[model samples]
Target: MKEYIVTKHAIQRAVERLGQTEQHAPHHLKQLMQTAFYQGETPGPNGFIRKFYDHFKTKTRLVVIGEKIITVYKFPEAVPIPFADEVAQVIKRKFAKSERDFKRKERALSIEIAEFNVELAQHRLSYAKAKSPKVRESLSDKISELETKVGRIQFELDEAIKAFNAIKEGAAKYL
Candidate 1:
């Protein structure tokens, strides 16, 4: 997390540049206050504009300068917050609404995996039924094909799991 800070060095530099505290106060102090007093969405919330967000904050700190509340503005610092987890299911569910593109894909992949498993079972049964060299060879080939398809599906599943975990961890760190 980063913090907004105006150090002693910065004040000293400002004083040196302006040559007089009174002169600096009249010219720049008001502008700085106006900038800081703004109540609106910052860059932190990406969906700030989309939703009905009504969070308001007031930042007022007293400074002992000529015995007055000289409103000051400093650049803000930012830190990220985790909005949600279970992002994998969220993405898959989003596919339901926007199904024109990927609905067929989702169905096809599931169907293919189911068919692959059924074919593997059927081939094993055939090998048991016909105890011959050619039958065994054919069953072996079919089993190999099913295994390949399952391997591909396994790789895709691993990737999805990794992506989900990475997103969770990365969002935990920062946005």
Candidate 2:
């Protein structure tokens, strides 16, 4: 078992804060050590002071001087933030809508790319069977243009999908 050497100043402070007497101070200090949740640390005159919150949300600051508890006191007027959960819900909804929009754009781009591929294939068949050089050249140019369009659309679709994935990852942290 770990033993804590409680300081005299710490006892007086705890007694004054809890409206208790000197005799009750040791029990109060024991309870504070047992039930407190670690809040954080603060800079003290000597060094760093460790802070904790008890069951009633009372902030207790204790400084460790060697093996002893140096100073213990309640930090003044700490309050929990309001509407944190509600703000999180609002952010989740906004990110969901953003994900949906990106997915929709990706679907539209994919459909356009599929159509361009089909058109390019048909133009290639026409270019192969054309009797005149002029008709074959025209069909070849059309096929090239369609191919470029398909490539651009496919690139845009990939970008949109990447955006959706990024949004999903970001929203997971909050929601």
* lDDT tens per residue, model 2, 14-110: 6777666888776767666666665555666756555443444555665555456656766667585598789789888898789778878877888
C-alpha TM-scores of all predictions: 0.38, 0.54
Q: Evaluate all candidate structures by whole-model CA lDDT and list the values in order.
A: 0.50, 0.74
lDDT at 95 for candidate 1?
45
Quote the RMSD, in angstroms, for model 1: 14.5
lDDT of 1: 0.50
Q: How many clashes in each structure?
A: 0, 0
Residue 13's lDDT in candidate 2: 77
Q: Score residue 38 of candidate 1 by CA lDDT.
A: 30
Give the clashing residue pairs of candidate 2, or none.
none
lDDT (Cα, tens digit) per residue for candidate 1, span 1-175: 2123333543544455434374454434333333343343233243323111111233322122222222233324455435544564565565444444344555666777787888889888887888789889988888888899888986765665565566556544532
